[model samples]
Target: MPRFEELDVWKKAARLSADLYKSMAELKDFGFRDQITRAGLSIPSNIAEGYERATDKEIANFLNYAKGSAGELRTQIYIGMDIGYIEHETGKCWLIQAEEISKMLHGLIKSVRSRTS
Candidate 1:
């Protein structure tokens, strides 16, 4: 396996985290902002952490963590939109991106699991 930075899913996750920080920069609610940003950051963070682990099984576990974070972030995006913290279109885009990332994570996990099995 190549470096985590070399992975497409990791790159996309990093971009999403950066975009989330930029988009939420102006929001006054610290709790929500922190929660969402942490969730966003978790996606790539977990991927990198997993890649650094000793075995494919460990990596797959971390990939699952990343996928869970993606789902958590998606839920927060919806709540943010409903509460007017995010615009409808912007929320939709973020949701779509999160979903895509989750799918990618799932694929990666499956690939790793197959090899380990």
Candidate 2:
């Protein structure tokens, strides 16, 4: 398998995390900002961590974690948009990107699991 760094899913996830941090850099709410950013960061981190593992099952577990984190980040984006921290257009884009990342992770998880099964 290619390294996680070479995976488009990982690259997109890392980009999403960076964009989220940039957009939230000036938010007045520390709690919300930190929580969302952490969730955003977790997606790519989990992907890389999973790829470093020795077994397919372990890799799949980490990919699942990344996918879950993507869902969490999408929820936060919705809340942020509703609360006026995020503009509707930006939030919409982020939602779409997050969904794409989640789907990508799901595919990776299934592929890895199949190797084990």
Candidate 3:
């Protein structure tokens, strides 16, 4: 496996996570800040962790967790938008990024599974 830092998807996800954190910090008053913030942080964190995993199955599990976190981020983005804690454009942008990350994770997992099978 290539280094975790060499993966484009991982790099993108890391950047997305950092951006999300910056955006979230501006909205500290959001009622569920801690939960949503953790979810956002988890997306890229899991991606990097999974990429560093020694086994294919382990990587797959972590990727699945990252995918789940992407879903959580999407929901949180919507909630943030609905409550006016975040702008629609900002939320939509992050949602798009989350969707992309999900696709990349799904593809990575499929590739790994096929190779192992």
Candidate 4:
């Protein structure tokens, strides 16, 4: 398998994390900003961590965590939109990206499981 950084999903997740940071950089609420950014960061971090692990099972497990973090980030994006912390179009774009990342993680997890089984 290619390195985690070479994976399309990982690349997208890393981009999303950077975008999130940039988008929220001016927000005044520290708690909300920190949580959202951390959740966004977790997606790529988990993917890299899993790929470096010893087995496909471990990789799949970490993918699951990445998926969970994607969901968390999506929810926070919605909250940010509702509270006017994020613009409507920006939130929509992030939400779409998060959903896509979750789907990618699901596919990767399935592939890993089949190979490990």
Clashing pairs in 1: none
Error of 3 at 12 (Å): 1.7
In angstroms, the error of model 2 at 91 is 0.1
lDDT of 3 by residue, 1-117 (tens): 787788777787788878877777766575677777788789778878987888888888988998899899889889889988778998888889889988988998898788778
| Stronger candidate by lDDT (1 vs 3) | 1
Cα deviation at 58, candidate 4, in Å, is 0.6
lDDT of each: 0.97, 0.96, 0.83, 0.96
Worst 10 residues of 1 by lDDT: 108-117
Which tens-of-lDDT digit does each residue in 1-117 have in candidate 2? 999999999999999999999999999899999999999999999999999999998999999999999999999999999999999999999999999999999898888888888
Model 4 has a clash total of: 0
- Candidate 1 positional error at 92, Å: 0.7
Q: What is the TM-score of each candidate against the true structure?
A: 0.98, 0.99, 0.91, 0.99
Clashes of 3: 0
lDDT string for model 1 (9-116, tens) is 999999999999999999999999999999999999999999999999999999999999999999999999999999999999999999999999999999999998
Clash counts for all predictions:
0, 0, 0, 0
Candidate 1 Cα outliers beyond 4 Å, as residue runs: none
